[model samples]
Target: TGGSNAFAAPEAFQTRSSSRPSPPPRPDLSSLASSAAPEQHAVSSVPEQKAATEAGVLPLYKIALCCLLTDLKINCRDSLLVSRAQAPSLPGYLDLVEALQQRVAAAAELKDVAALCSVFSGFLRNSLLPSSCSPDVQVRLLHALAEVGLDQRRE
Candidate 1:
């Protein structure tokens, strides 16, 4: 019983497969050669392709703020469906706002964009300065923040 139960030998596995047909030979490389300079065109297309990619990606903070703003706006305007979205996750919402402010501040001349800055500043203040924090306060504060980012467009 022990001899019969012994595991198959390694040679047995390899020898068993020998009866199968071998794979076909690889194609001849010389016949596949082409004159097309795909590399040249690829190099030329890199920058344009990169810019197009960047154009497609809006700043995430701006998008999140836009979503939060829209949520607030719909609730205010009495649009039932849009207003029903779950409230923005607080930590994520705050981090997004902070990131947006930092990004905007770094990219723009703060002095020249004072008025625009104030709107965001005010929104941040309202979100923090209130004695009792509620979803309503957060929503209103976000509208003010969204307005600040939007205001930058006019200037």
Candidate 2:
């Protein structure tokens, strides 16, 4: 029986064939070299072409500034109060206001109130103000705290 089994295994091995045919040789790439040159040229000129095409478009900063100004004008129209004082009492009030406005505009553009709140929180945390502060400062802080609370509640 063992002899017969060994003879059958040899026959099986002799009759075995590959399941798939061998692949053909790689084609010559020399013919495609000339076509590749034009593709590379087209790719290289893409940015210059894009710049030429976009020349008529408004700059991004200008567009953002326009949108921010329009939004502020519409939303903050009622909040704009004419003070009797000739100059601001605080030295950096104008700068602070401008910074806050820019931050608000950026936040509005990105539709991210949490980022704005985090930024304000960091500012307040790092500020030189003490716990016992003026009423105006206390009111502003309270407003910020309320806004953060509301944002948390919404989430």
Q: What TM-score would each prediction reach against the true structure?
A: 0.29, 0.23
Residue-wise lDDT of candidate 2 within 1-155, one digit each (tens)? Answer: 01121111223333442334679988886665675556574554776766655543324333443343343334332232232132233323334334544544554323344333342332333332212333443334334434444554477
lDDT of 2 at 58: 24
Estimate candidate 2's alpha-carbon lDDT, on a 0 to 1 scale.
0.38
Clashing pairs in 1: none
Question: Relative to the true structure, how large is the alpha-carbon lDDT of every model?
Answer: 0.45, 0.38
After superposition, which runs of candidate 2 have C-alpha atoms over 4 Å from their true positions? 1-35, 38-61, 82-155
Q: How many residue pairs clash in all the candidates, one count each?
A: 0, 0
- The candidate scoring highest on lDDT is 1
lDDT of the structure predicted as candidate 1: 0.45
Candidate 2: 10-residue stretch with minimal lDDT: 1-10
Give candidates' CA RMSD values in order: 22.0, 27.9
Model 1, 60: alpha-carbon shift in Å? 26
